[model samples]
Target chain A: MPKLINKNTVITNPWTVMKASTGPEILQVVPGKNFIVPLQFWKLYQEELNEYDGNIAVWLDSDENPEQISDELHSLPLIALNFPVFSDGRSYTNARELRQKYAFKGEIRAIGDVLRDQLYYMAQCGFDTFEIRHDQEAELCLQAFNDFETGYQSTVAEPVPLFRRR
Target chain B: MYRYDGYDHQMLADRVAQFRDQTNRYIDGKLSEIEFLPLRLQNGLYVQRLAPMLRIAVPYGMLSSTQLRKLAYIANHYDKGYAHFTTRQNIQYNWPALVDVPDLLADLAEVEMHAIQTSGNCIRNTTTDQFAGAAPDELEDSRAYCEIIRQWSSFHPEFAYLPRKFKIAVCGTVDDQAATQVHDIGIYIVKGDNDEIGFRILVGGGLGRTPVIGKEIFDFVEKKHLLTALEAILRVYNREGRRDNKYKARIKILVKETGVEEFKNKVTKEWALIKDSSLTLTDEEIDRCQKFFDAPNYQELSNTPTQLTDKLQSNILFAAWHSQNVKPHKVTGYSIVTVCFKETGVAPGDVTDRQLEQIADLSDEYSFGEIRISHKQNIVMADVRQDQLFELWKALESGAMASNNLGLLTDLICCPGGDFCALANAKSIPIAEAIQRKFDDHEELTNIGEMNLNISGCMNACGHHHVGNIGILGVDKKGEEYYQVSLGGSSKNNASLGKIIGPSFAQEEIPDVVETIVGVYKEKRIGEEKFIDTYNRIGIDPFKEKVYAKAD
Candidate 1:
């Protein structure tokens, strides 16, 4: 099983991704088990999400808006942003908007195509849990964070730049 | 030049360390080549056709003598004993082993320099006019804001990855020497109605596949709100730019698809959110950035030196060099001297370690121990004293660095095409050499006058063929190379893309076609109208008729 990483430490991955399904073939999300469903499913099956007694987590596509689902953050265990491919990076700014403006308190996870080189930037933009590809070594991904110790811009983790601190 | 503080030093040092680890990881089979590509690119290492080419950023084209010497040291030690200066004001070492790039980064860090953002699909190095601080007509010194943006954009977590590479050019001069109109983001510094200086923000302008002049989104953004406004634009592009097709991925396509007005509205909404944020430029921060770019201690020479005037009257070559290479400076008795890299037979912008060393010496002796790499791919000693110009010219001639062609036809802007670049469809340097040889006569070239001849191997437009007055694009037809000629492109204040005259030509036909174009212009031109103005008035038919008829 692939483990999630938060600040270079391995943790249990609690969410299962459910891609879009046809009519009457919707996923049977279990109660008390965190599940990550596409944004389309959340809108179509709002009744089901409300009926569930457990936590809900939604993964937003590159073009999707976080503002649509930010109101439901009180009950979510995680808000995962999807990077469909390695080159697609709209999720980076989306992650920043969620943390900086929306004040999201739950775990913000980066999933799909996540690699070791991008971990330092992911962490800086307020992502706590990274869903590394099942093919990647989770232990090796941790080393990416130790390399870059300084940053020029103010991120969610820091309110001011290093120049201001200096 | 902006001096690196302890924080800046630490940040660059940490990047070297990070890149080193990333390099080792890839070598150990821990990271795939696909996964490692962006990482290496962010460090300015490109796996080229021959070997890796490392492009190092020379921010705003300003480099101290110390920094240049270190570049020379790196060139001599790593890969070839030379470096190529790029149109974007970056220095590229065309050959380096991938294994040694991390070590190279470490050495560059010792000089407070790094290859960060030089090649990645991120906000690359911000370029300004080479005479940013020295130009007489400039409304403000733009290097201050460039330095600020450099800091804000460096290691920017959000913009570390973009759909395509983004470039920004800033110019404070009345004449757009930095080609601001053709950049992804062109910041034109100007005075507002109230005499307060601000930037005229332009977006979506680029040259690659579909060349479009950027549209202005704002007449004037206050200096304090500069960073805030830019952050909004970048956020909009980052979120909405196309990711499906790499060719259609630049912010230009997004702006064109969404329309500038709608794109402006999106950016306006984003700017509203961050207007009062910490990214807003405070007076202290602004002053701090500006202090680093303060002019050097210029000697108080009120009048032109008699010795220089005498030399100009006595020597014809010196007079010719002075007429073409010397530009008027804001500070009295100090002139901007352009040292040409476009020697007749040599590859444009390629300078050896010995030339770099010689230039370092020249900078110390003539200018204020400073140098600049222009967008036109030449070096400039922007603050050279008028009295010292004669001596400097003689010294430059001794080093074979003195060429009296600044904007002439032979002074061609060229790309490292098929010979070096992997994307090039054909070789560009040979074409440039051919054209220079055709127009080799000094007096004849002078008589022809003020033409921008540019060559590119492909539509990528690295040579900025789109804006060249007389542009050449090399196309491959059935495994053979052919050249297409375009006319009337300009990158000045009134910038426009070139128009294809007619069919393409063979390698041997380029010079003859160019000569025919010039010949037609000379015959039909009214008074002193240039080739561009003549083409604009009489249209391409006359030149087309002359060339095609000859070819047939």
Candidate 2:
């Protein structure tokens, strides 16, 4: 199981990422279990998920745009942004859009290909939780937050640019 | 020069510490090579053919004397006793041990320099005209905006992992010295209707396997909205740029495929949402950045001092160098002096550690302790006093830094090709040397004045071959190396990509091919018209016909 950092603290992960549906089939959700389903799955089965879930969240692939589910953002507890590869950073934009453009107040979690070196930047892009890759040590990744105390640009963490703040 | 305040210094130190940890992790088998590739590359470390090449970012080609000394120290201690200045106005160490890069970066941090975003798929250095603040035709200083872009792009969270590397250039003068039109995004500082300054943004311009002249996306973007506009474009690109093929991944490909109008519409839509956000620049912040680039103290001296006039009359060599290498500065008494790195037999842009130190000292003594690197891979002492021209020339001559080939055919821009780069198809420095040797005659070179002959080892166009008036691209023909020559490209305000002259040539035939092209230019010349102007008037057919006719 991948250890998770939630709100800058290491915590036991309760969410299970469900297998993505390939076709038009809607995935059935098991009751009383926290689950993170694919965006397509949530779009197809949100009505069913509303009645039978302990906690249901949607995960977006790197190519998926947050605006696709912008109307439903207020209802979701968390939105997991996937990094198919560590360097494919489209999800970073998705996270920024979810937090900034749509003004989504839910927890924005970073999942898949997440690692220690990327945590500070991921956080700056508005990700509050990280489902770090299982091969890495999560406890050690905590120090990544303290890697840079400040950034130059107007990031999600700092709304104003450094020059303005100065 | 932009001094690093406490925040800037702390951020650099933090970045150094983080990179040190990343390096240690990579060495300890905790981070795989695949995982560490982008991490190391974004930090400007490239494992080349011989060893790791570390590129140090000279922000907008502006370097302080302190930074120059530190670069010299790094080159001497960590790598070979010399470094290469790239066409992007960055300095690259051709040989540095992988283990020592972190230490070198730390040393750089002490001088407020770093290798951050010098390479990799993110936004690289934001360059500007080497004569930005000093050029006579200047509208406004573009370096301040370049500094703003530098700070914004540094470790940008969302854009750091772009599909391909991006370059932005800011041009403040009428003459596009920074080669703005060939960059990923070109920002030309233009005056508005009310005489207020704004930006003219061009997108999708780049040189690589497929070179494209950037199209104007926004005719005018207001001053405060510059960063917001940039963010909108970058965000759109980040979400939409192609990732399937590395060659097709640059924003140029996307802009070309999407059509500039449609791309502009998307950016406009995105900008509407974020234009008034906290990213908007305040007048105070803009003024703060502008203050750093304010003109140095100057004594009101004559534009052409009697000593300079006497030297020009008495010394032929100094006259030649002054004619070719010096430009009019905005200030009456000052002149911009280009220190030529294209001395014959030496690799273009390669400077010895001693020369780097010497240039540093010269910058201090002659140019107010500031040095600027032109994108043409030469150094510039941008504020030299007219009265001290002769003395400065003597100092430069003593150190062999006074090569009188500033825009001449022999002063070609050549990349560290197959000799050092892992991506090069063939060697470029040898071909450049061969051409330089053939055109060693000063009178003949002067006759074929203001030529841009650029050579690239591959289609990556690091040497900017695509925009050269005479471009040589080294192509891998099966197992053998062949050179393809292109004609009529210019990186000026009216920039265009070069057209291939004909079929490729053998390595030995490059010098002859270039000479034949020049011979045609001389024959077809109409009363001292420049090479590019002549080529444009007569087209490539005449030169192509002659070169192939000789072969036949």
Candidate 3:
């Protein structure tokens, strides 16, 4: 399990990503079964506000209009989006816009192709939680977030503009 | 020659510290290769086929003697004791280790330099005329404006992650030595009818697989609103530039898709919102930047030196060099000397550490402790006294820097081909060597007059081969290297891409092909007419017939 850092707090990430399985053990949105809402599911089930709980995480496409999601649903406790590939940085912008512009104050997580190099940028863009691949060492990737103590530009994490810094 | 102010210094120092931390995290296994790639690239670090290539920005090609020495030191201590000058007027070290880059940047920062925005999808180092303040035709020093743009674009929040990398070039002279027309944005500073100076803006010009001449957006942009206007253009590009395809992502594609009129309307609509904002320049700030580039104190002397005249009449090599490599400066008795890098058997822009140190010393002694790297891949000592020509030439000769082939056939602008670059389709260095060998005689070269022969390893056009008078493109056919030839292309005020002459030939046949083209020019040219003018008058058919005669 990867250690998730929010502000100064560090805790073990609770989500378990498993390959597709069939039967009662499939775990379709059980009480404790943390689930990631795919783009298709978010589009289909977003209207049925009562179906999903605060614990249900939803994935949002970078190009999708964030306004489509009801503001009340933003109070969900967890959310994770797919990065798709190393070069597909749209997810970072999506994560940032969701947190800063839309004011979604929940635990935004990064999933799929999320590598160590992007940890700092992802954190700056307001992703507090991360679900890295099972094959990678999550502890080492977590340390990469603070690689640079100072940045020349302001980000969502650091709202103070560069010019305002002494 | 923009001096570093407090803010500029602070920004660079902070960026260096930030990159240092990034490097530490990568080394500590905290960052994965995918995560760190963009951050490292934005800092001008690239993993080439052989080793990590670090590109240090030389803002507008102007450098102080102190900066040059630091570069020399870095080259000697870190890399293979040599550095390659890039077409973008920056220097690239071909063999810097990933671990030592932060330290290398710290060395650079001591001289007020950094590698920020040198790569990635960001505003790149702005290039301008090397002879900015020294050129006789210059209306104002373009380097001052280039510095202003550099300051404005450095770590700009909005434009950092554009659709593709952006480049801008400024030229103050009518001659257009900076190759302005081929940049993403080309700004030409001109004096208005009211005796005030402003800019003529050309947007969407670029050279690559697809070459397009920039269309003029504004005849005169008031000097004060320069930054605001630039901001508007960048905003539009950031919002609408294509992201689906890398090749079609440049601003040119957007401009072409939405015709020039519509594009102009969009820019105008955006500009009206912020035209009078704080981004607009004040006269006080412009004058302050101008102060750093104030002309050096010059002693009045006769334009022609008696000793130089006597030497020129006696020594043919000296006479040839003086005619080809030296240009008349705005100051009397001082000349701008171009040290050509297009030497035979050497890569076009490769200079050793010893050569760099020597040039730094020469700049201190002869010039004003300043040097400029020309877009044609040559170095210019912009303030050499006429009396010191012989001594300077002698010093240059020791290091093979006095090539006397500036603007000649041997002065080829070539990219590092298959030998170093993974993207190259074929090798380009051997073809350049063959042509250089073919035109070895100084007297013959002098007679041939000013000519530009450019070669690219691939269609990426890193060498700016499209604008060469005689352009050579290396193409691969079943793993064999073949060269395509073009004619009459230029990058000056009347900028035009070259026209291909017919079929491609094997590498060995390129020198002979070049020789035959030169022969045609020699046969048909009018008195004092250049190879370009002659080819332009007679058309490509004559040369095409001669070159492809045996093949046909």
Candidate 4:
């Protein structure tokens, strides 16, 4: 099992992230396992997913708006924001909107293209957990959170900008 | 100038330490070059043609003597013995080792400076009028708001990784010396109907492959709602801006594609949610930032004193310099002296380590230990006493900084193009040099006065060619270099982008083309009309016909 940073601590990730497979075949939801589905897949098969006994969470791609799941937010345990590439930053806005705009209290996890250098900023944008990219050492990446003790702008961690706080 | 408090010091220290670790990781091969690109760029490091260019941020172009001296030391010790002041009011060191950057950053941190957010797909250094505090026509000192924006935009976690690089410029004066109209976000500090200070916000303006003037997004945003409003705009851009193509990723494209009205509506909707949040500025905080930019202690005296008048009458050189380089200061007895960097053979904005130290000393002696870097890539001693004009002129002349051409054709803004930049299509320095040599006669240049000649090596438009009165863009013609000339751009209160005159010219013919264009302006002028005035009055057709006719 791969380890992920959850709420600033490394832990074994229980949820299996299902990416859209090659070709147009629809992804099947396996029973009795924690699974995070793509937002479109989750939305398309919500009734079928509701009948399954497995714990289901929705994941959004960089282009997917978090508002799609706003109506049923309280039911999901986690909402994963995908980076596709670390430089593609739309997911950061998605995470912030999930937390601040939609008031989604469930876990907001950063998935795909996640790296040590971006962990601090990801955390700042209301991402409670990060699924460290498979190539990165998750244990060492834990130290990324402490890279900056403070920032000037308002963040999920600190809602007040530095000027107001000062 | 705003002095660093403990919090500011701590933040910079943490940033330096963070960069040091990132550098070590890269050296150890733990982080791949692809992954390290944004990390290095966010710290203002770029792998250029010759060496790694490190751009150090001078917030709102304000520099204290101490900071200037520190930069001089860095130039002398860390990299080459020279530095280039960029069009964004930041300074770029062209030759610096990638390994030594962390230590260089540490040295800069000691002077309350860092290279953070100077580049990369993040919010860049916020710029303002070089004469923000000293200009006679200023509504209020724009530096305070620039400082405010600087703090808000610095390491803005969500906006840090935007689709493209963002720029914001603030103008407090009636005259737009900062060239705000061409920035991603141009802020004009204005008075509300009730006399409350606020900002007129313009969005989507940029200069690059596609140059577009900013649209007025909001007529007035109250002082308190500034950051929140900016936040809304950034949020809209961050989520919706084009990321598929880097060339079309600027906010301008989004504004254009979405239509300005629709974009404005989106931003307005977003702003309503966050406008009254904790990010809203308190009067105390505003005052706190404002206090740092308060007027310097001025000894009141006559505008042009007896001593200055006598010196101006006695020496023609001093008189010429005063007539061109000096401008009236908001405070009587003081004058704003532009220390020209456009010497005939030199790169427009390049300054030697020795010149940097000399400028620091000069600032301390003549301008209350303060200096400003103009967007035109020149230095300004904003508070020089009029009585000491002769002495200052003599000092500047001795240092070879007293070129009596503040706005003449020779005082051009040319980018460090093919010589240093990896993206350049052609060399801009030689072209700038050729034009400067052609227009070397002081009397002729004075007659062809107050014209902006800007050159960019590529479509990046770092030299601000889009807003220059006369502009040049270097293009790669079948792997060979050619130059495209444009006419009638102005980056003032009424900003306008230049129009391309005609077909491109070979490198050798650029000087003659410029001369022919200037000739047309000189001949067509009714009376005392500037190059831009004449070009605008007669239009580009006359100049285009004459240049091509001469070519045939």
Q: What share of the true interface contacts does each candidate keep?
A: 0.67, 0.82, 0.04, 0.82
lDDT of 3 by residue, B1-552 (tens): 677656667667767877887789789977677667878988999988898889899999988889889999999999999899999999999999999999999999989988888989889999999899999988989988887788778766456567888999999997899999988899999888888899999999998888888899988999988887887788677667888999999999999999999999988987886677545677776787788889987888778898788888988878878888999999989899999888888898999998899999999999989999988889999999998887888888887888988988899899988888878998888888999999999888878888989999999898888999999998998888898888988999999999999889999899889989999999999999999899889999999999989566
The deviation in Å at residue B42 for candidate 4 is 0.5
Per-residue lDDT tens digits for candidate 2, residues B97-153, read 989988999899999999999988899999999998999999999989999999999
lDDT of 4 by residue, A1-166 (tens): 5558865678778898877551213334345777788877787777877776778888999998977777888788998999899999999899888888888899998999998999989999999888888888876798888988899888888998888777
The parts of candidate 1 lying over 4 Å away from their true place are: A22-32
lDDT of 1 by residue, B1-552 (tens): 788888888888888878888789899988789888988898899989999899999998988788888899999999689999898999999888989888888888887888999987999999998888999999999999999999988989889889899999999999888989998999999899979999999999999889999999999999989988988999999988988798999999999999999999999999998888877778888898889888889989965789888999999999999999999999998999999899999999999988999999999999989999998899999999999999999999999999999989988899999999999998999999999999889999888888999899999999999899899998998888899999989988889899999889888889999999989988997888888888889887888889999977
lDDT of 1 by residue, A43-84 (tens): 788887777665667888888978888678657777889878
Task: State how far residue A162 of model 2 sits from its true place (Å).
Answer: 0.9
Q: Candidate 1: lDDT of B472?
A: 96
lDDT of 1 at B240: 89
Residue-level lDDT for B158 in candidate 2: 82
Runs with alpha carbons beyond 4 Å of true place in candidate 4:
A22-29
TM-score winner between 1 and 3, please give it. 1
DockQ of each: 0.71, 0.85, 0.13, 0.84
Clashes of each: 0, 0, 5, 0
Docking class of 4: high
Which interface RMSD values do the candidates have, in the order shown? 1.3, 0.7, 5.0, 0.8
Worst lDDT 10-window in candidate 2 chain B = B46-55
TM-score of each: 0.97, 0.98, 0.84, 0.98
Winner of 2 and 3 under TM-score: 2
